[model samples]
Target: TPLRKWEDVERTVSLAAKELPVTDMHTHLFSADFKEQLLWGVDELLIYHYLTAEYFRYSELSYDDFWKYSKQQQAELIWQELFVKRSPVSEAASGVLTAFRRLGLDTSSRDINIYREAWKNRTASEQIDKVLAAARVKEVVMTNDPLDRSEREVWLHQGNTDTRFLGALRIDALLLNWTVASAELAAMGYQVEGEWNDGVSGEVRRFLKEWSAKVGALYIAASLPGDVRFGGRDHLTAMLEEAVIPVCLELGLPLGLMIGVRRQVNPSLKLAGDMSMKADLQLLEAVAVSHPDLQLLITVLARENQHELTVLSRKFRNITLFGCWWFLHTESMIQELTRFRTELLGFSYIPQHSDCRVLEQLINKWEHSRTVISEVLVSKYKRVYESGWLLSEEDIVRDLNEWFGGRFAVVRQNAAKTKVR
Candidate 1:
């Protein structure tokens, strides 16, 4: 698997078991630059030096190639299905009608007659069909929002290629980015409760009820702000409560909330390229959306150190928290990375970091911790804890010792303070 053209298999295996042995087919296989090229369909010779080496019969596919091919194939399939299914606009019209009724608007004969006439006159369904047909069907998730005249055009063109392919790969879970309030999300039938400014009100509970009926599995992204009235934090607890209502009552829906994080504005790091770490931490702590069954993603950019990574790892369970570091060839790492970004960030907005090492390390550590807890501890405990399954006093000491490795311990309360000249 390591030598297979695509590293995804190797990565996937690694994620499945934290102790899985990993061997690189070639050193170049780990190179970010080469991986990028491989993604763009690079040649074998460029991928492996042995192909260019004298007297060596080069095997065509490496692990990376197979993975890349798999991606392309899956993307094409999703495109095909999306085109074939052609989700009807009548669903949307029906939803709007229902909403009108909830909002106290009459759905009587007069209103129905007017609506019927408008529906007949409007070519909304036909327009949606046309947009899907015209989509270019690129096999990549847009790095940024793309310009498309019609909403349907954007969905067809920009649907999560990465997520679709990963799901096809049969990973445990996939993270996705979305704003519940966005029109696309609404079309997907995610109900919006009370206004964000109003905190989590009865309306939010109603929205979750509607959403749960439709989506058997749910992930909600959320964040908190310092301001009590309007920020995500105020409503997040309510949101989670809403999610569990149906799940607990045996409504047949399994719900998860990937409490999203948003960076707070900070000016101290003016030259530090976005010093929003503290703000992100605040959001994580204030509205801790930790649950044993649910997968929570903590999405934040690293500030070029392991400090933030260590702190986050110590907190939160069922968390796929992403820092700036990761193993490109590990599935668990990739999955965690995606969870942090998509599941958590889908609701929360954390800016991307440019540094590779910090990002990569974040990924590795997150994968390591998640694998240990989910694969091992969660089953053993079979019950949730406010602060994760108990770590022994010895375990705590060991972790602390590791944290302060080789750093001097205090000498009997430091006897007396010495004045510095």
Candidate 2:
């Protein structure tokens, strides 16, 4: 039916955005097959890096003291500090409440054990189902690291049971810290060495190819610093030029570059310790110039780099910007990013990735994202509608499809001809 009225267009956009099953291109989420590696439940949600970072902002707890406590004790401390002493109003705290309400837990009771009791009888499989359903996420790509011993054991030995989870080969360690990654690769019986040579490249490529096939990797991924560049001293640039890009071309996978991450700025915070910087855009321009056919999935962590990233996307069909990654995943950032990303790129960009580390995070992440995206769509539709373009329900659905999932497929494997096998 035609969306003749402004109200009708608003309804259409909201419904489409809400019901659309998101294709989360990057998540630290694992299937139930990962066993203990898969983090879920209320305690896990409370102690997540984001909340832990927030917990430190107000509490007088020392990093050493926090580290000494168990996950349960940490969660209880976070609950008392972040939720009880203050309001559960911060986005991270709000996410926990959102997940609780969706899971049918009585958040009004304000007790941590009540939340735990709700999750008591629920098995892993049930948790996955309920969370995915609540999030309306049809597919999620897991960050698969072959060098990580525990995850490696699961992939090579136990095997992944959930078809809903696809793999993206994480190569930051391989690219940035080759000495450490190479030693592990050598230990695993891959003939990889620290020196950069044709033989070394071939061995690294062979390892990537083997693992890409093992996990059916949809793409290769890396998180790099703002200072990343081509023709550099670092192994990162060399690995991309030699093994990473070549293997990507061979296996029909894109390189998802999550740039500008300055790892461990506050060493005490551990995973939450990282920060972002304005990456030199020339790095991407150089790679895009060199390999026109190699699809590049890009996301910039710093707000300073967003406009330049969007403009770069304009120049290269090979480059597709995705997600408001890391610090930029909040509601305001999503609103600002999605608005300009739409105004500048039209429907060419992939809107957002969940980047979720826990199972239930999918609920709050997508819920917040869908709300923000729907507003953007409605306003865009209204502008064209008032211009006598005469929008329809079909138009909103079609664009929403591309915005959420369709564009990912096109950008990911369309350039390369072969499957990873």
Candidate 3:
């Protein structure tokens, strides 16, 4: 029977959304082997990049002075200014509160020290399990950089340290800024000089092959600037065509393009200083059109690009628009994007990617996103039910699984088969 009652529809949708296990398609999160890389606890949560950006406006401290302080000191200052001095009304500030509340902690306590001590008692692995369980995250797709010596050593020695931490090869440095990447690649004993010539292209392919095999990377990804173009005759584009795309094609891996990160607007603040700008959708369109055989997973950083991206996804079968990234991760934006995506593309697009640098963030990120997703699904399902269409519990679960992470599983399975052949 159709879910005729509003209560039935709402309950069904909410439960599906909440219980659906998520596969975080993109994140900077690491495994237990790299415990130092895992950012958790209240201090890390409070001083996250989003809050850091907001902290600057209220802070009297200059960028240089702020950088001089230790992580603990920075978190203390942020807590004092952002939470204590003023109201924690903003989305980023409130997110910390949400995390605390979800984690069975005292949100009423403004004491950072208390929270820190509580967090310190939990081991990294235990916390990861707790956070994943809380987030209902099935697997976390990690952004692995082969160029980073620390990450490289881990991959070379430990391989994949955790089953939950799936790898994605991040080729941003090699593709976007070849000058620096060439120097780094050479230091790592790769013969590529970062030129667009055959020698460099071959070395790039070799590097990709090695890393892809080592980590069984699900995809090859790169974070591009807003101004990135596809049809260009430049070195970068040439490399993309000659090496990157071909390697992905050979490996049966999709290309995950995270476009529109305007790096370091305020140089002193480093990672926190990065911002977003509206990107050239035409470039994305061109890539999708040119590579009909290639599957591309794209997420633009700017909110304005959401509708256009959805429209593009509708037009191209190979292009899958996923996530409301960084600045666009707010509930309002997620609701807007998810609603627009469902209206235009049905449930074909992936609604969210945690992009969490910290493990615990998976908790609040998914919790907030799931609530918004449920709301959108309920409204959409209600409209469909009114139109005399019936959707079963099985149908809702199927859709939720696909949206959550089942699609990713299929993609990975296909890649695995291709590798076997």
Best by TM-score: 2
> Which candidate leads in lDDT?
2
Q: Which residue pairs show collisions in model 2?
A: none
Q: Write the per-residue lDDT of candidate 2 for residues 1-421, one digit (tens) a residue.
A: 7767888889888998999888999999999999988999988999999999999999898999999999999999999999999998877789888888877777798788887987898888899999998889999899999899999999878788799989889988898888889999998898886567898889999999999989889999998898878867667778888899999998888988999999999999998899888899888999999988899999999999999999999999999999989789998999999999999999999999989998999998889999999998888887888898887888888999998999998886575664445
In order of appearance, the predictions have TM-scores of 0.28, 0.98, 0.96
Instruction: Give one digit per residue, the lDDT tens place, for model 3 in 1-421.
Output: 6666768777988998999888999998998987577777777887798888889988988888998988899999999999999989887888888888888888888888888877887888889888888888989988889888888878778667689988899999877788888888888788986346789889889888888878778899998888978777886688789998888888888888898989988887788989899898877888788987778889999888887888888898778888989888998899888998999988787889989987788888889999999999889888888887888888889888888987666655544444424
Q: Which residues of candidate 3, in runs, are more than 4 Å off?
A: 1-4, 410-420
* Residues 222-329 of candidate 1: C-alpha lDDT, one tens digit per residue: 323222221254334443444333232333222222222233232321212122222345434443443333333344333322244334544554333433321122
Candidate order by decreasing TM-score: 2, 3, 1
lDDT of 3 at 157: 83
Better of 2 and 3 by TM-score: 2
lDDT of each: 0.28, 0.89, 0.84
Rank by lDDT, descending?
Answer: 2, 3, 1
Question: By TM-score, how accurate is candidate 1?
Answer: 0.28
| Residue 382 local lDDT, model 2 | 79
Tell me the TM-score of model 2. 0.98
